[model samples]
Target: MKLSFLIKSLAGAATMVAMAGPALAAAQSAPSPVTLKGDVMLEKIVTENGVSKTQLVEPKVVIPGDHLLFTTRYHNDGAQAVTNFVVTNPLPSAVALASESAPGTEVSIDGGKTWGQLGSLKVTGTDGASRSATAADVTHVRWTIPTIAPGASGEVQYHGIVR
Candidate 1:
């Protein structure tokens, strides 16, 4: 009898709490509003040597149909060191990549700005001329990495089909 009474009391308490306040109702209906406010101000430091460079470190060119294994290396010359950086390469309009490497690096089909994975980039029409990236499209190019460690270097290479 005592156990049964305890359970009933708990259930009654729960129902009362549920109906007791707007906070509970709001939490159940939708997540409670959240406000986050903070700021970290740091003086910007500019150094002559703080420069980032991306270059084709290896073989510049390859045969038209051959796999042009071009490796691009990025260097961080900044004293403070940079982190969580992404490296990208845009494929020129005239040329397309080989079958094994049709999708080029960071080549946003939508334009030449945003980049994503190869499979995500859409080729609407293969009619070469008709097949083009438009503003409505969200074509992404292959990014070297999702993130790069500070003061570190990374490389990415891909083949292209010479037009």
Candidate 2:
């Protein structure tokens, strides 16, 4: 299949070593009140010749210092316009949130129990030292989409670094 070849070709062309395939993409229940489906994805950032780029690849295997991206696509399958849509996603334990841009988005560090902007979050170390939460302490990501017309689709994503 074309998709299988594309994955393999991209894996080989990327010039990175990883035996694993893409991470398992997940779709939590649609944000309530909107008949939409959310799909998740993983992307790898590749820098070559000092020019960096990202490709849609799996994280079959990654180094602790590697940077990655987690994205979600939402499709409005209903016949009505959806408003005030919010999407939430949990980050994997292996990666910390990367300083990236996501308009109208918030993050959580307490297992999705709370949410806030990065500078507003704090992570406490075992040494009794409390410091501002870095990308590494991010445990979840959320996005608030104002509206999506019928038959239209939108996507939201955040970057992260492998721990």
Candidate that would win on lDDT: 2
Q: Mind giving the per-residue lDDT tens digits that candidate 2 earns over 16-132? A: 434222322223444433444443345666799999987766667777777666567777877788888888788888777777643245988899999998788888899989999
Per-residue CA lDDT of model 1 for 1-163, tens digit only, reads 9999999999999988877887767769752122122221211224457764323333344444433443466655444445445544555443454445444434566555555544565565766544444322432235545444445565555545444
Per-residue error for 87 in candidate 2, Å, reads: 0.6
TM-score of each: 0.41, 0.64
Best by TM-score: 2
TM-score between model 1 and native: 0.41
Q: Lowest lDDT 10-mer window, candidate 2? A: 19-28
Evaluate model 2: give its lDDT. 0.73
Error of 2 at 54 (Å): 4.2
